[model samples]
Each structure stands twice: as structure tokens, then as C-alpha cells.
Target chain A: MIGEYITSNTEIVESALTQSLPPAWQIPLPLRESMNYSLMAGGKRLRPILVLAAAESLGGTKEAALPVACAIEMVHTYSLIHDDLPAMDNDDYRRGKLTNHKVYGEAMAILAGDALLTHAFYSISQAHKVHGIPAERVLAITEELSAYAGARGMVGGQAADMLGEQGITKLEELEYIHSHKTSDLIVFSLRAGAHIAGASHAQLQALSQFGHAIGLAFQIQDDILDIIGDEAKLGKPVKSDEKQQKVTYPYFIGMEASEKKVRELTSQGKEALLQANLVHPERLLQLADYLMKRDH
Target chain B: MIGEYITSNTEIVESALTQSLPPAWQIPLPLRESMNYSLMAGGKRLRPILVLAAAESLGGTKEAALPVACAIEMVHTYSLIHDDLPAMDNDDYRRGKLTNHKVYGEAMAILAGDALLTHAFYSISQAHKVHGIPAERVLAITEELSAYAGARGMVGGQAADMLGEQGITKLEELEYIHSHKTSDLIVFSLRAGAHIAGASHAQLQALSQFGHAIGLAFQIQDDILDIIGDEAKLGKPVKSDEKQQKVTYPYFIGMEASEKKVRELTSQGKEALLQANLVHPERLLQLADYLMKRDH
Candidate 1:
């Protein structure tokens, strides 16, 4: 299912992420080097692809969601860079290569993350140059992206994650962390696409619900994979959470139950699209299924 | 002169900075706490006041520049928090109190700095609602602020400083470091005020020149202060720069020459404002003199 979507839109997503960055001369060499290092690192480009898929599914062209999709990926990359820092996750490798801090040193890594995150908004605002979009919609999209990436969203999730690592773990705590850390950006990506495509309010509501369910399912699948996936395939150590005694869905609910929960959530996510009468829901539904069933 | 400006605008600047932040409830408590800690820690509110003073000097109301002022300070505070981290300057104290990392662990400090920087733009965008500024103007202001704070500006300066600490020291290198590290934000603060007030292109150019001169002068004076000022008066260690063997202006060009350089720069800064025929030029002239002649 995922392979079909990838085959169809893979070039679009790849080109968008690769070209999203400014020209080399515009940015200082070292800074550009650090930013490009992590951005060009291999990954699924999942968030951005989802953005395009959702927009197309809503009967909008890929151009409408291109900037937003790129911005989401930039934010995601920034999170990964910061998360790998010594003070945070402290991982030495990511995607089978040295993490940003390990390669660029701690200070530059931090600044690189910061620069990328700040630049993401600039990218979104530039999307206003798109010929037909209304100014109000551009402003609204910019505002929504900021809220999701700022304290109320991703940063809030990070703060909770840090605190959670050091404090007692509860089901509520895990849910809060997952929702904010992982789900908020996903919700923002879909909502932003809908807003750009001029989706109706009811359609937006359904899309948002679809985003939330699939987002949570994605995290749950991650938890399951961490317990059983191969390190080489994952491109990072597996079972690190178990070794660290970190709380996760699989750890708390048992693997079998966690798998069942993912399946249920995936179905609900697909139901949201059906309710909205989305024109082409196959890609999104398949994405949900792929997320729930992926090994790594 | 800076002292007079600070004294006269102190109340307005302080009130704006405090109120610019969202209420604790809107932001997560931990993020709010960290932001407030660095923001409210007593220091010269030089940047924010410059922003307001520049706007007022151009016949705009204090309200016009309030958000830009607060955003400049937010950028400043974020830099300070990050600079004080163990991987950076490793300072345990700032403004005579435990630094953000010292008070709140390294992880929270990192997150706090990230949150503040991201929220700074959010604050700028909110200016439209608060002050009835046009979104285009706000976007321009944000773009300028981002350029000053990002890799090409303050962060670039910081990287230069870090590299200079470990390599060959030249007068040009020292100038580059100070210009980027200290002056870029100052230039941005003044330009932001001009942008907010919708100053003429000519007036903005003059403000840019004035900002550049004063920024360099300010850093030269800081270099001098490290060698000559009392530690208690400065609120941080004295001669610490020399002790650490960090490249500094006074070290590159003897203390006497550095002082002379500051006097020359201050006169040039005042001359820029004079050429512009700005009303209430005394506020900025006084600031230039104060920056060049400050004891702390």
C-alpha cells in the first residue's frame, strides 16, 4: 500500500525537500553545510508526502501544499537534530550516520537546529507568492504553523518528554507526550494542507480527526518496532527504550494489545476520510495501514 | 546618554517586555518559567529600549514598537541562555544569579532557549492584532529579525567567536566576531523600530549607519570593561575574557587604542543621527556616549 503511494509521489516529495533549502551562497558555508547534512540524510520523507497526499486527496494540486510540506519536514529535521544533542537523547548515530552534534559539535548542532526551525516559517510565508492564494489564507497558514511548532505544540511535547524521562510514568503522561511530540505536527501538516486547498470547514474537521488517529497509530507502531525491529534496518539501536526503562505503548500495554490498538486506530483514521467523502482516500488509508504495520 | 534613555524609557520598556509574554496558562508552565527567569533577570534592557526609542524618535507611539522591542529582547535572552551552557561559555552565573541551566538543568535550558527564539517571531506576528500594523510590515520585520538572529548574523558571530578561541587571532577576525556577535542584533533592533514606524527609506538607511557605529562602539567598550571595570559593577567576572584567552578587541588593538576607537565610533554614530535631522536625537546620542564610556 505504502509502496504504491511512494511510487506515485516519491519524486515530488524528494524534489520538494531537496530544493526547499536556499542556495549555498546565500547562507554561510558552515551553517549551510550543517543544515544540509541532516536535511539530506536519508529518511522516508513521510510528513511531507502525507501533506501532498492529503491535499491531492482533497482535490487540491500538489503546488498548493508544497511549501507547507517542506516546512513540516524542516521542523521534523530540526527536532531530530536537537533531540540527538548531548543534553537530550544523546544519540551518536541517526539513519546509520553520525548525528548532527557528533558531526558538527554541540554548539553548531544547536544553532543549525535553531536556524532550520526559524527558516521553516520563512518558507511558509514565501508560499504567498503562489499566484491565486488569498493573503488571509497565507497569514492563517503561517499562524497555524507557528502555533504547532511553538510552545503550545512541539516544544510543549519536548518539555513533557524531558520531564517524563526523569519522573514517574503514567498512561496519561505517555499519551500527553505522544500527542504533543509526535501527533501535533502531523495534525498541523494535514490542517495546513486543508487550509491551503480551501477545504470546507466540515472537511477540515474530518481531516484533523484523521490526522490525530493516524498520528497516534504511527507512534504506537514505533513503540512496537523498537521492541522487535532489527538495529541495522532501523538505522539506530533497537530496544534502547527497554534498556533505558522508558515508558512506551508496547511497554505499558503489552505488544499484542498495542498491535490491536494500532489496527483499531488505523481503521478509525480511514473512517474519518469516508465521513468527509474525500475524493481519493486510498493513499491516506494506505498510509495509515502502512504506519500501523511497518516493522521499522 | 544610554543611562538617560534607559531611565526615561525604563517603565514602558519593562512593562512591554513583561506583558509581551503570553500568560503562564497559554504557554506550558515550565517553558513560561524558563522564559520569565531569563527575561526578568535584571540587566540593562538596552536592545528593547533602543527599539522603542528609535520608534518614538521617529514620531511613532511606543505601542508601535513594543512587540519588536520585546522580540529583540527575547532573541537576546535566548542567546545568553545558550551561551552560558556548559558546551559554550560554561558560566554558572549571569546577572548575579544562577544562569538558566544552573537553575533549570541543561535540557530545560536548551528547550527554554529554543522556545524563546521561536516565540519571538510569534510575538512579532501578534503585533498586528495589538498595534494595528499591516501584516506585510510585520512580515518584513520578522524577516529582518530572523536574518539578524540566524546563521548569517548573531549565530554566525557566535560561531566565529568559538572558532577564534581555538585558532589564530587577527584584528579583522576580532572585528568580524564582535560585529556579528554584538552589533548585528543592535542594528536589527534599531532597524526594526524604523520598520515598525514606517520610516522613510533614507531615514532607515541613516538608522542603519547609526546602529552599526554604536554596535561596534558598544563591543569595544565591553572589551575595555573586561580589563578595567569592577566585577561587582559588571555583575559577571572581570578579565574573564583575557583569562580564557578569547580573542577580544582590547587584546587585538591595545586597550588605549580600543578606547580611542570607541570614542571615534561614538562620534560617528552621533553624526549619522545628526545628518538625519532626527528629533530628540539626544536619546540615541546619549546612548552612543554611554555605550562608549560605560564603566560596566
Candidate 2:
């Protein structure tokens, strides 16, 4: 049943994403192709699923959370596009396909990412105009989103991450990178759902705590997967964190410790959700378990 | 008087921008430095000034539009940074100095531009939180901004401009590039101010007409200046447009015809402004004239 729930939601999210973006043909061919290359390439669709699951658990319809969910996905896609650039992660493949820059060239890749980032807001705005979400909440959510994604949040985290690998990594520095680069947006995804659902302040705060824990757990699991997950299954090389001579959860604290950390965080996240008095937290809790153990 | 107005407003905008961004010493040093390099570099500050001028013309306080004005500048600065990348415009200098990537490396330059573009919305959000602007109006303006700046607007324009240069030039294709790339934001600046000030529907439509005319006129003048303007005053080298064999107004229509077109558009813009029945048109008119006749 949980698998069915996630699968159905993933399909729904993909459909919404397809419909949300300006028709690919409406923009220049190259730019739209580059954007679609990454966006449509298969991934977990975890971020948007989190948005819907959180909203549903908090007593909001998937329809109300659909736009916000898609916006979160757009932001996620933009980050992936930029992070894969030659100057950044310098990866040639993502999800087993050529990276955007490889096909579109670096300039077009950058532009495509820029378009996706800008269009995230456009998605929310459209929802407001036609879907009839209250304009005021949309404005507040927009403000919150910018804060979560901009210099002080995701971009800031990315910058720290670039700087963090220069030498022997300190735990504090690593935490800063993971929490901001990974956790900030994840936390924002959950809160975006809660915001649309009109959750009380206490509920919102609890969801934030839950998301932060799950986000950290998610990254640590990724670190673990890089060592143990099948390369074909993950759609990229394994042990890249080790190959790069960079710090990761297992590298910093040992694999056993990393595994323990993920377990503790997952429990904490679920507990926080339970304490928030949700009408249906089972789907989200199941999702956290799935992501924590996912090979990819 | 016009010169004094521009100078004073420029100072005001520069101060707000400085105050608004992350401190240069925040989470990452290189990222902030690269963002500041282009943002703080000297230019005419035309976009932000137009924003303020539009607000003043429409009977809104300069203070009310200040944050929005700064946001526009951030967006402009981001565009310039991306446009100068090796795969794009491939320029080494802007505003008479080394371009951002030249100074900070390509990765940092791209990240900095991304940071600025994301931060533009943050700046507007802060204004919404503190400036006592009505939330619904802020929402409206935010919607309008996404339309003007997203895939269908500035991004779309840049894409068309890039493609238009690959083949024979047509006036219609050239106009699409100019209007979207150069004028979309210009028009957005004017309308953002009007939306905040509660312009009537008729007045808003007229201002849109005014902005469109001025925006077209502005690009034509830029094309002209690329040939006839002083390189020292303009900062970047002149004639690069011709060097690229790009379709430009002067190259396509001849300098005399282009100048005449600019004059006609400027007259149309001013006529539209007069029809809007603005209480304080002198400042905007003066600004437009200055832009039209500018040597730089």
C-alpha cells in the first residue's frame, strides 16, 4: 500500500510538472530541451512527494499542494543542473544520461538552470492567479522560498560545500554544508505543504524539525549508498565521494557511525511528526523509511 | 535638475543595494565577492532609476519603490554576468573592468550570478514584509515580474537573440530579441511601480504602452551607440555587435533610419505617458530623454 501510495504520487507529480512548465515549444528549442533533459529524466521525485505527503497528513488536498510541490521540484532540478556543471561537480552523467552541459553546452546549461529557478516562482504565481490560492499566502510562501533557496540558504550551503573540501574537513563545516545545502530546501518543502494547509504555528514548527532531521538522514544515506549501492541502480559511479578525496559522513565518522546516525535521525523525524497530531502520518513515515534505505 | 535628480537617486539606490545583500564576509567569501564585483561596479543604474522614476511619476513614494528598484538591478546584474560567459558573449570586461568570471573564475561567477538572481525575489519579499505594501498588490507585482523575467520574457528573449544571430536577420526576429532581452525588464520596472501605486486599468495599460515604446527605443539607441559612442564612456569595446555579425538596428536598418525609429518610439512613449494623465511626468520624461540622447 505504501509503495502504491508513493508510486501513484510520483506519477501525479510528474504529470503536474509536465503541465506546469511553459510548453517546451513555447521557448527557444535549445533552452527548453536542456531544461526538459534534466527535469524529465527519472529521479525519486522525493521533494514534491514530501510536499504532498506533508500536506495530506496535515489535512490539505493534493490539489492545493500540487503547485508548491512542482515549484520545489523545479528548484531541485535547477540545483542539480548547476551542481553538475564543469566548474562544480564536473560530472558527465546524471541518472545515466549525458549531463545538461554535455548536450546543450555550458552556456545553455547555465541559462536553462536560470530559467528553471525563475520559473519556480512563475509556477506558484500561476497557481495563485488561476487556482485561486489566496494571493497573500502565495506572497508569504514566495518570501519563505527565496530565503530558503537564496544566498543565505541553498546557495550559501553550496558555497560552503565548495570551500569545505579544500582541506581536512571539520565536522562543523560539514554539518553546515549538509544542513544548508541539503536540509534547508528539504525543510522548506515540508513547510511549503504545511503553509498551504494552513497549519498552526506549533504544527509548522514541528514539521520543520521533522524535515530537518529527515534531510540530514537523507544525505547521510546518500553517503552510505555511494559505497554500497549498485552503480547501475544508482545510475552513477559508486565511491565518488572517496574518489574525490572529499569528506562524507562515512569518511568522517566511519560507516557504522554513519548508519547509526541515519537511524537515530529517522526515528527522531518520525517521532516529531507523531507529536504534531497529524491525521495521517503513516505515508510520510513510510516514505522516510523508504528514502533512508533506498539504493539510489 | 535632471542630472541632480539622477545623481541623488543613484546614491540612494546604491546605499540600499549595499545594505540589502549578504555582508561580504558572510558564509562564503568568494561567492559574495564575485556577486559584489559586478553589482557594485559602476554603471548608469538606469533600471533602478527608472523604477524609482516610474513610482514617482505614478504618485508613489521613492521609498516605497526602493527595494523593488534594487531587486531590478540585481536581476540586471545577473543577466550581465551570464551574458559575459565564454560560451555566451565571451566578453572579458564590463563597465571598464574585468568581468566577474575573469576575476573570480567561471564557477564562482556563475554561482554569484545565481545567488543574485535568487536574491532579487528575496529583496522584494523584505520590502513586502517591512514596506507596508499591501500583500495582494505585492502578489500581483510578483506575478507580473515572473511573467516578464521568466522563460517567456527575458530568458526567452536572450534565447531568441542567441538563435537570431545564427542565420539571416529579419526585422521581426530582431524586434523580438530587443523587446524581450532589453525592454521586458524595463517595462516591468515601470509596471511594478504602477501596481504598487494602484494605477487604474486604463492608466496601467497606457504605461505599458509607454514602457514598450521606450524599451524598443532604448535597444535601438544601444545599437546606434555601439557604432558611434565613445568606447571609454561606454566601458566595453564598441562594435562588438558588428564583430559578431549579429543583427542590430543600425546594421539592419542603417544608422539614419535607426535614429529615426528611436525618435518615433520616444515620441510615442511620451505621448502614451501624456495620455495616462500622470501627475508628475517631468522626471520620467527627463529620464527617457537622457537615455535616448545618452552618449554612453
Candidate 3:
């Protein structure tokens, strides 16, 4: 039922992203090409769709939320690029194509990632001024983004996850990693969308909790997919996480336990949305349902 | 005479910069540490001082402009970090210490640079709110920052500078490289300070021009120092740029002509300041004088 909204919003978000990036003919040819290459490589556009949907769920128009929605996707794409660097996950491909470093060399890849990150702020801060949204509102949204995306949030989570790979793996530590590395930006995207929409304090709180739960469920589902999903659809190598000795929900706990936990989290996420009394949460619910059921 | 003001503001700028970064005890120990190591390595803090001094010149308090001052320094420091990476200039030492990747390895260095850049927006966006400045003003400053600091400005300049090393370099191309690479942030910092001070449009324009001239003169002087300065004081090997076959003013023009150009640019910078009729222009004049006379 909500697929129509998703399709339309995805188009809006993709166009905004394509328009937001600098063209290839710019002085820095390879950097822009590398950025566009990864960003243009197809994905489901889930995070950005959530941004638009979250705003719409709180009575905001999709058109007004497009800038930030695109900004979040840029950030997500940058993280993927950096994560796939030789010093990190060491992956050569993402979404079935050469990762940024593989195509443009490591230095340009690093610069491309840096450029994308800085451009995200640029897009949100300047690109949206034409829409006549209050700069203060945009300021608040950009601030929240830096908080969730930066060291104390996603970067912090990534550091911990990297450190954890070599050492002990407590469940609580894993939770911290999942919640911050994955869920923090997810929660921020939702809140940023809601803040733009002028969602109330209660509603913001509800979305925060809902996004947190969904973020964890999403990661767990990823873990499950790595264990059981097909090689072709997953793009890169399947079961590579296990091969890399990465900590996963199913690795520590049995597959059944992980499945039970994802189910519980999905229900809890929907319950949080219900508790908020959002006027139009049907779209959000459908998005959550799709995530909960997705294989890749 | 104005050296006292520079000293005091440098202290304030340093202290504020120290406080601005996420602490080392945070989950991302290496990222924060690498960021801090470079940021705290102690440069002149001239860019940030211009921010504070420009504000004070227009009847604004230093405390009010501290957040922006710190933010600019963060951006500058992040650039240095990235520039020193093995993929870029590949310097082993910066500001008299091991470059970040030389100490923490390439990946952490890259991530640290990313974290600092993102955190600059976070610091500027959230930290300045407590000073009771309107959020829109901070928003404006941050937006200006992303514009000048991102691809169209500094990054573009850097890419040109990098590519220029490998190709035919025109005089105009060199100007574009120097103006964007070295001058954009300087201009942005000065304008940002004036913006916070509520300076008139005329005053901001004057500061922008002043910064532009000073930035070019500063880079020219740096080229001169590379040829003749003491290695001990410069902190790295002298003539390293020549060794790397990097472009420079003295390389294209004779050293005498380069020195003559710096003198002209320095005088032009002060002329802009004089035309502005700033209330407290003495300190800025001193800064220009210092830049003109600096040898190390």
C-alpha cells in the first residue's frame, strides 16, 4: 500500500542527490566521479526514504524534506566508501561494483569521502535556503546530524566495533556498537526529518525510540541475511562477516534467538510509534514492515 | 604593541580549541587522540585570531566569537591532517611532530580527519547557542564555512594544486590555486568574525579583501622560507617542496620578484583595512605586519 509513496520519494531523493553533487567536469575529476559512482550505484534508498517518510508521518510535506533526505543518503554512502577502504573492511566491491578506493585510488577515495561528508553539511546548510525554511530550523537539523554522525556517535561506534573485533565480545558491548554505529544515525535521520516537520516533543521522543529499535532490528536482519542470503543479491561475498570473525547477533546467540529478538524489536518499534499518537504513521509502519521482512 | 593582543587571543583560541574537541576518553580513543595531537601541535592560530579580532573590532565580545574561532581552526587542522596523509603530500612530520598517519596508521588518520571536519559543524552549531546569539547567525556562519571550505573553494584549490604538480601551470592557474587553497579559509574566517560582530556589509567586504591579500602574501612568504629558512624552526626539512617538485612563487618567479609581490600584497591588504575604517583596526594591522615580516 505504501510502495507508491516509497517509489516517489526515492525518485525525489535520488534526483536531489544527483543534483547536489558536483559534476565530473569540475577541476577535481576523479574525486567527483568516484563520489557519483558509488552514490549512483543503485541501492534501495531506505535511509533517505525513512527521512521523507518520517517527516510525512509527522505531517510534513515530502518536498520540503528532500534536502535533508538527500544529505542523509550522502552521509550513508560516504560511510560505505570509507568502511570499504583497505585499512578498514578491506572490501573491493560494494553493491556489485568496485568500491571507491578501488576505482579512484586510496588518496582520492579518502578525499572523496571527506568531500561527500563536507558536502552533506553544505547541501543541508545552503542548498535548502531557496525553500525558505527558517535557517534556525535548518541549523538545528544540521547540528543534530553532526552529533549523530560524528565521533561521539557513529564514529565512536565504529571505533568500538573495530576495537571489539580483536578482543572480547560482550553482549552489552555489542549492543553499544549496534546502537551507536548503526542506530545513532538512523535515529538522527528520523529526528531531523521530524524536527523539520515541527513534530512535538512527545512525537520526537516516540520517533527516537522507534528508530532506535528499528536500527537494531535492521542490523540483526543484516547479520541473518549474511548467514542465509544468496551470494548474487547480496552483491559482495556472503558470510564474509563470519570469515572476517566479525561479531554478529546470530554468531553469539543461536539463529532462533536472533530471529526472536528481531521480531520483538519490530513489534516494539511499531508500538512506540502507536504510543506517540502520530497523525499519519501508516507509511512509517509499512517501511518498518518492509525492513523487517527484507533479505538483502 | 598589538603583539600583546595576539598573545592573549592565541591563548584564548588555544584554550577554546582544546575544549571544543571531543575528549580522549570518548569511545573513539584513537580518532580523538589523532585529532587532538595535530590540533594541539601549536601553530600561530592566526586564522582564529582574525575571527576574534574581527569581531572585537566591530564592538562584539571575544567570548561571543570563541565558538566560530574554534570551528575555523578545526577546519584548518583537518585540512592539514588530510594533506599529510600518505596519499596526499605524504609528510612524516607536521608542526614539529609525527604526522597523524605516521603515528596512528593511515586509516585512523583518515577517520580522525573526517571526525574533526564533521565535529566542526557540530561545535559551531551547538556550542554557539549558549552564547545567546540567534541560531540563524550561527547557521549563516556554518553555511559560509561549508561553502568556502568545501570543493568549490579550498578542496577545489587543493585538487588544482595537486594536478598542477603534474601539468603545465599558467600564472592564472597558480593564482586560482593560491587564492582558493590558502586564501579561502582566511577570508571566510575574517568574514565570519565580522558577521558575528554585526559588521556592516562594507566592513565585511573590506575584511574579505584584506584576508585575500594577506593569504596570498602568506603563501608567497612560505615559498620564500622554504628556500632560505632554518630547518630547525620550520620543523621539517627545508626545500622539501622543491624536492617534491611542488609549485611555488619563488620557483616560477625569481626570489626577488616573489618577495616584491609579497610586499605589494601586504600593503594592499592593509589598504583594504584602512578603507574599512574599523573601530579597532590596530590589532589587524599588526597581524598584517607580522605576516609581512615572518621568515619562519
For model 1, the interface Cα RMSD in angstroms equals: 1.9
Model 2 earns a TM-score of 0.97
List the candidate 1 regions with Cα displacement exceeding 4 Å: A1-4, A7-10, A22-28, A57-61, A129-135, A198-204, A273-282, B1-5, B25-28, B274-282
Q: Put down candidate 3 lDDT per residue, B129-179, tens digits, no spaces.
A: 678777767877877887788777788787677767877466777888889
Model 2 per-residue lDDT tens digits across residues A151-242: 88899999888866667557878888889899999999888888778777888888899999999999999889989988898888888777
Clashes of each: 3, 0, 0
lDDT of 1 at B285: 76
TM-score of chain B of 1: 0.96
Colliding pairs, model 3: none
For residues B1-296, what per-residue lDDT tens digits would candidate 1 score against the true structure?
A: 45555886877777777886767776668777988899888788889888887887777778878878888888899899999999888998887899999988898898888878877887887777678877766776776776777777888778767766878457887888788888889989988887777777788888889998999989888888878888899888898887787777876778888888989988888888887766666677777777776788
Chain A fold similarity by TM-score, each prediction: 0.96, 0.97, 0.96
Better of 2 and 3 by DockQ: 2
Runs with alpha carbons beyond 4 Å of true place in candidate 3: A23-27, B23-25
Across A1-296, the per-residue lDDT of candidate 1 in tens digits comes to 57976766767766877787767765557777898899889788888888888878878888878887888888899989988898988889998999998888898888788878877776777666653455556666666776777777788888888877856467777888888888888988888877777778898889888888989999998898888899998988888887877888977789899999999988998898789878887878888878777777
Query: Which one wins by TM-score: 1 or 3?
Result: 3
Clashes (candidate 1): 3
lDDT (C-alpha) at residue B175 in model 3: 83
Q: All models, DockQ values? A: 0.46, 0.73, 0.69
